[model samples]
Target: MSRLAQFAVFGHPIAHSLSPQIHQAFAQQFGIALQYRTIDAAPDAFADAVRRFFAQEDGRGANVTLPHKHAAFALADERSQAATRAGTANVLTRLADGRLAAHNTDGAAMVRDLTDRHDLDLRGHDALLLGAGGAARAVAWSLFEAGVSTLTIVNRSPEAADALADAIGEPARVHTRYWDDLGHIGSFDLVVNATSAGTLGQSLTLPFSLIGSRAACYDLGYGPSAFGFLAWARAAGARYAHDGLGMLVEQAADAFQLWHGRRPDTGPVYQSLSTRSS
Candidate 1:
């Protein structure tokens, strides 16, 4: 028995996450045995619980997800430029002196999954983003930075969408459209579903026609949750349609890199999960 590095994903309703399996695969690539688990902590107790987790001798990092990403950013002693730009943090690392450092890997996860995995060139592509929650806000800026020609954000709450667009800066490039106007917004090279509509098993009636002939559709949810959106994409004849599983593996690899200076090969891990879901 040797020393083990401990890490976990912190969020509410985390039972279904594939993070532990993904991180385990990453650690095995470097011959490093690690402990990773899911931590279900509400916003009220997130900061305190995280403090305790890192207090462990082997505590190395924690991947923040869902409703906790913004809270994780708030609790960190220092934040990386990525986290600051995204207005959220999904990865928390224990600094050498035992302080929490925050980084948002979600946006980079999306970029990597789209570009590296699918070879979709995000640069100069028009994108339509669904939802304006924490996850949406975190990735909105990243897409713009990735060189999206224009980003049209649509959400139930028009005000929330407007605020997020404003925060993403360059008002001219980032604009908000009402949910009802989704269909009328015309086509997009990239249609990204950032809404929780998929997770709740709610039937989504998206305007998949918005997917251009050569467009790609991406759901932020993995597995079954992502099926609704991806199915719509496939039916709409999208060039490529995918779930968030790749994003999960890539982001976990990013966190692993932050914790151990090792970036794992994500192809096999992603294929493993994809096969399981299929």
Candidate 2:
């Protein structure tokens, strides 16, 4: 048998990631044999770990998550426009010449999941993005591209939110507010939770006033980490409440296509995982 292609996801606290299963499902669709592993590396060890992994001849590509996304972008020899725009990369592909290329699939995938899967129209919607970390940075531009009229960013650290807004370079359409000001900022048509509170087993304690009568609330975290925000949104009477599972699957599909030159159907995989998560 020919050697199976090697791929992996790099992140801290990686045991909870569904990347391996998601990618394996994609590979099965094409009768492609591949192995996807999870490498838990702290910030200090990330670059070295990636170097070691790609040193292997079969190391075809890698999916970067959480804290490692920006690191992966820096480590890459080249970057896609999406990566450059986001200032981070979630997917890394190994080129024929042995150099790694970085791509950011997070924003595009989230947009697809919202517009295609959930039928949420982002055009002209006033969106509120909570958190200004890597996750927020990755998807902010895409929200604008999807035609949101305005984006209000809030983070625990006001400076961080300001930095993200400045990076977006849209002083008119993009604005920042202190985390404590969420309650006073008024309601939004679309609310997104991009905070790590969920992953860290904490709650945002968001005010009910943030949800408009017809607002759609989405959390960038999935599984157990998403429960708190989803529950809050539901209690606040959000018109639509969704976890990031769909986005996760969509992003993985993009990464799969990037690595394999074929796009796998994500419906079955997403439904299967949804059942498991439920």
Candidate 3:
């Protein structure tokens, strides 16, 4: 019998992750038999848990999610440029030398979905990014690199947004807006929701003026919870509103490529998940 290749996604509360299903679909495309699972590792146990998993002969790779991306970055022996810029890692693969290499695919995934799937031009476009967490940081640098003329980050904790903007080091181009001043901000071509509001079953209110009829609003969260932001965007008169399902599929595709050296088509899997959800 062939040895079963193994992979998993790690997080503090991982029971809800769709990663196993996504990876299974990707592997099936190439007739590769693999076993994927979710590992609920506490913050203090993350490092050891990851080390043991990769030490296993059958382990191929792993995905890290929420509250652990930064720890994964520290645990990696080598890191990708994306990971270096984001100061976080979400994908990990075992190297030939028995070391773990890390990569951050979140930014690339978001950019691809926005430009390729949505066909929204980022060149010289104004963008508003909500939240100042890891997800926000990962996409901020990528948005800037994609040629967004002005990027304003708004957060409940203004200090967090300020620190992120400072780290990007282009104060002239990037700015931070206080949460209370969201009403005064002008409409942006694109508004990205990177906050944890959805996870908390909460929604944020922004001035109607901040969402032009042609604006696109995207939330970096998925599932039923993500509906909150999408609903708000639609109510606020956004022309295009969407959740993060596409981003999830695209990022997982990148992770699969890093581990297996083969990129699977994600369209079918994305449609399948969407159909199931609907």
The digit string of per-residue lDDT tens for model 2 on 1-278 reads: 88778899999989988999999999999999898999999999999999988985468899999788889999999999889877889999999999999999888999999999999989999999998887788789899889999999999999988998998899999999988887798999999999999999886799999999999999998988999999999999999999999999999999999989999999999999999878
Best by TM-score: 2
Predictions ranked by TM-score, top down?
2, 3, 1
When summed lDDT is taken over every stretch of 10 residues in candidate 2, the lowest stretch is 51-60
lDDT of each: 0.87, 0.92, 0.90
Cα deviation at 239, candidate 3, in Å, is 0.3
Per-candidate alpha-carbon RMSD to the true structure: 1.7, 1.2, 1.4
What lDDT score goes with residue 180 in model 1? 91
Would you give me the overall lDDT of model 2? 0.92
What's model 3's lDDT at 124?
83
- Residue-level lDDT of model 3, residues 72-127, one tens digit each, is 99999999988987889999999888888999999889989888878988898889
TM-score for each prediction? 0.94, 0.97, 0.96
Off by over 4 Å in 2: none
Best by lDDT: 2
What is the number of backbone collisions in each predicted candidate, taken in the order shown? 0, 0, 0
